[model samples]
Target chain A: MIISYFIYFKLQESDFAVTIFFMITVTEIEKLATLARIKLTDAEKQGLTKEIDSILTYIDQIKKATLDIDHTPIVGIVHNIFREDESRVLPPEDREALLKQAPEREGDFVAVKKIIAQD
Target chain B: MIDLKNLTIKKAHEDIKSGKYSAVDLTKAYLEEIKKKNPEINAYLEVFKDAEEQAQAADTRFKAGAATLLTGIPFAIKDNILIKGRRAGSASKILENYHATYDATVIEKLKREGAVFIGRTNMDEFAMGGSTENSAYGVTKNPYDTERVAGGSSGGSAAALAMDGALAALGSDTGGSIRQPASFCGLVGLKATYGAVSRNGVMAMGSSLDQIGPFAKTVTDAEIIFNTIKGNDSLDSTTISDTTYKTKKTDKKLTIGIPKAFLKGDGINKDVLKNFEESIENFKKLGYEIKDVELPNIAYSLPVYYVIMPAEVSSNLSRFDGVRFGLHKDGKDGIDDYFETRGAGFGKEVRRRVLLGTYILSSGYYDAYYNRANALRRVITSDFETAFKTVDIILTPTTPAPAFKIGEKISDPVAMYLEDIFTVTANLTGMPAISIPSGVSGKLPLGIQMTALHGNEALLFKAGKEFLKE
Candidate 1:
């Protein structure tokens, strides 16, 4: 709805601390909100702009650390998992129980707003 | 009337078996304390109505001569962990009325042992923030001081234990969620080695960093609970067995390493450093060698964690699209419906991470931000591996300071994230770490944290027990 109408813009270098006006534009935040699938009020966007700037600035320190070592092995515990090609469906009772929690349910199915609508 | 304050799982089991107190009686004692303190502390979001029924079942098991150590024990569970037929909302409104249809792997294990669950405790919404102030229900106040925060995203579980509301509680650590709270509340908290415990039913935060561990009054209790829940599960393929990261049992005293970089920083409180030094001296008195170890990449842990965690958070949280379950907000179109549901459902902190993660993983920025962070993650993790060769354990203060006033860091996201600086290294490296109460700094509790090589939790428990004695 509101998120889809917001246009995504390219992040220009001027987006950072170049000028007070260039700090974080509403267009940039709208793009991020659309990508994250969350609608932000104008007030929320203004607040987020400031918060995200500081968080990004803090995390920017990682770029300074040199990645001098080649082939940095992925952390120790990562392993490939292989399972048998078998199909196991949830029991009927459990299926019903889970379906009961859906916000919009119609008979045996969970309903949702139509996705094919054109603007 | 059973005494809830001094109760331990071991003592509770003995008293139950000796006819000193029944399981129902023990459960009732904790329930009474929960009723008394939960109103003010807000530790438990909802105390289960079936608590008495669970205790009754445990009592029946004890009567039939089928009691295990955890058979009659009562526990408070962090709301993020699923328990069949119960609400596990992760302190967010999206799942406010959602009921779990099946038990989490750990819940199934505990159920098989007949452990009585007292209630679901509060946490930061989606386990995103460092303070329980992010909880949709409300902030969980520190039991020691109501004006201050109980460190989070597992703050409720820590507060529950601190107030004797539950015997022990289960908490998930993505990055210092469990340990920092335990440190704040003055309890023993453990973050098991990555994949040492299955995360099949826990709310996904950062998949690479998530782990389930326990909060207890004593190190022995934490170990017992850890051993009961830890094992490779078919449901969670990432889990590993004790044999995977085995360490040789040495007769020589264990060597404790201190990364000098984290010890004397500008933000670190002087009292915290004092407690850490006293803990080091305690280890030396116990005949362990204290050595200064250099972990060059350890300093970059926070930035690496910030980048990597949000990337995973954005990906893992995509499942809440309002079509399947949880909250659903009607809109003119499908896309609008998603925006409305998520925007209204998630708390402010959850939305912050989701958006931050999206930006990091989006096109044109992935290589510059996310990839570089991943490379740094590898450097940080391998550095710990190298350090472990020279030292059996690494020690530090659990947090830079004790519990802060409730509104202190809420406005500053970076300031709140700094709480995890000491604890995130263990999660990054897949190593087990424990936070044991050192003493009090002023009215607030202080904790000394120790991290060991992957699957070397036995060393933590042994050292924690020896250190706690002093």
Candidate 2:
């Protein structure tokens, strides 16, 4: 009776872990290819799923290695690589040259046919 | 047996200047090679319909004494980099017919020097995946082995360089896109110190991390192109406020750092380890000391990187709606057009990243995931600071293993991500990194990667110069 209880408790723990894994999957990855405009087939999805899980597993290693979460992520001792910002006037045809490449165009503005944002 | 295909850019340039080889002749040689090998290699997305015209123009420039460093040098640029009058889709269906509004900053620079762009190369759409498998067109196979992957997201550039499709190629490295593919395809690839190259018109993945790099068969070739492209630009504010080095190489007396965390990691392949060790021994014999340095936060880069990169990607890519630019899927009337266009245009991987990015950056979870990940990104960058102190350069295996068999790790994005472990720190910390072919392991070649801090590409180039066999 005690053994059965222990097994049941462990099963529950694993099930929760799996469920959490599913949740943090960042739904953005599913749409990443679309936003980037590429296609990944179903088999590719399975491959990426397994790969992402392994990466997450390895990431879990960081929790064990460093307890200090406040440490800054960027490391060069030098403070910044900022350069002086300068605005130069683009040549007249520059915009036209670029806008011409758009599939659909409005005069002077590259015409985009649709908005991808969701409500 | 003219050995024309084996000619280096400098050698070809010399021949062209001496009138021994016309730019047209050199261009024809490459086109013939592309025609012969591209079916099996698949390096080019589209062979220029007017390659002959472009070459003739180059020959004319030579006659007029208008040749620049890249003058008449036929090369390929990754499609992500814009070129005037060329379709600039980044291997994604949504922008399948998209063209450049203007030359990308690097393209502009190269163009001034008289570089003849043969065609655009393939990539993982939006420079997302480490392998070219994510492309909507088709997977770019390894040049070394047709059945294996040429590491991406710059696979096409690497493939083109390895098989002599171009004298040199340009690719963007957003997290090992340039270096890893160079490793898989046995070529030299460099990710300039962040902002060292202008990002004026390049499609961004993670703006903070994206860098334009070069692909070539030799370190010198890579350095030549790097020299031509590197400089401070008023166009990009993030470029090093001050330039790093005037020349492409650094003086010796440099300290090389080898991160223990990576050298002793779990996923490292045996042959990769062996080649890396052998190359280190050669370097030591050349009088450089290899010190063991520890960057503890290095291990967590992927999660932080994936989270932050996609979050930024979700934001940067928000512009590609069906309404304004790119491939439009016609819908009933026009309203459904928006829905169907993006829905049909974007591929699965692209959608996944966008959606994953969307979730992370969403209001409720932004602090825990996106903000925390950004904090971790700082931590990862800081860790590099502590390590770069005692060393001028860091060396590691470019990939955990050589080119994996096609479909071996394609299904597992995490495993594929792991393949980029050795190369990501460069992106994370905004350091310059280069991958150089060390030697062949089995049927494939292994790459040795070295990195230098901001404005220190000279060290990478200097080190890369010693290993050239040509």
Q: What TM-score does each of the candidates earn?
A: 0.95, 0.85
Q: Supply the TM-score of chain A against the true chain A for every candidate structure.
A: 0.70, 0.48
Best by TM-score: 1
Model 2, B202-299: lDDT tens digits are 89888888999888877888889988887667667676534443333456566788886545533567888888888888888777888998886676
Residue-wise C-alpha lDDT for candidate 1, range B331-373, written one tens digit per residue: 7788889999999998899999999999999998787678888
lDDT of 1 at A99: 88
Worst 10 residues of 1 chain B by lDDT: B260-269
Worst 10 residues of 2 chain B by lDDT: B241-250
Off by over 4 Å in 2: A1-20, A24-119, B241-249, B332-336
Q: In candidate 2 chain A, what residue range of length 10 has the lowest lDDT sum?
A: A1-10
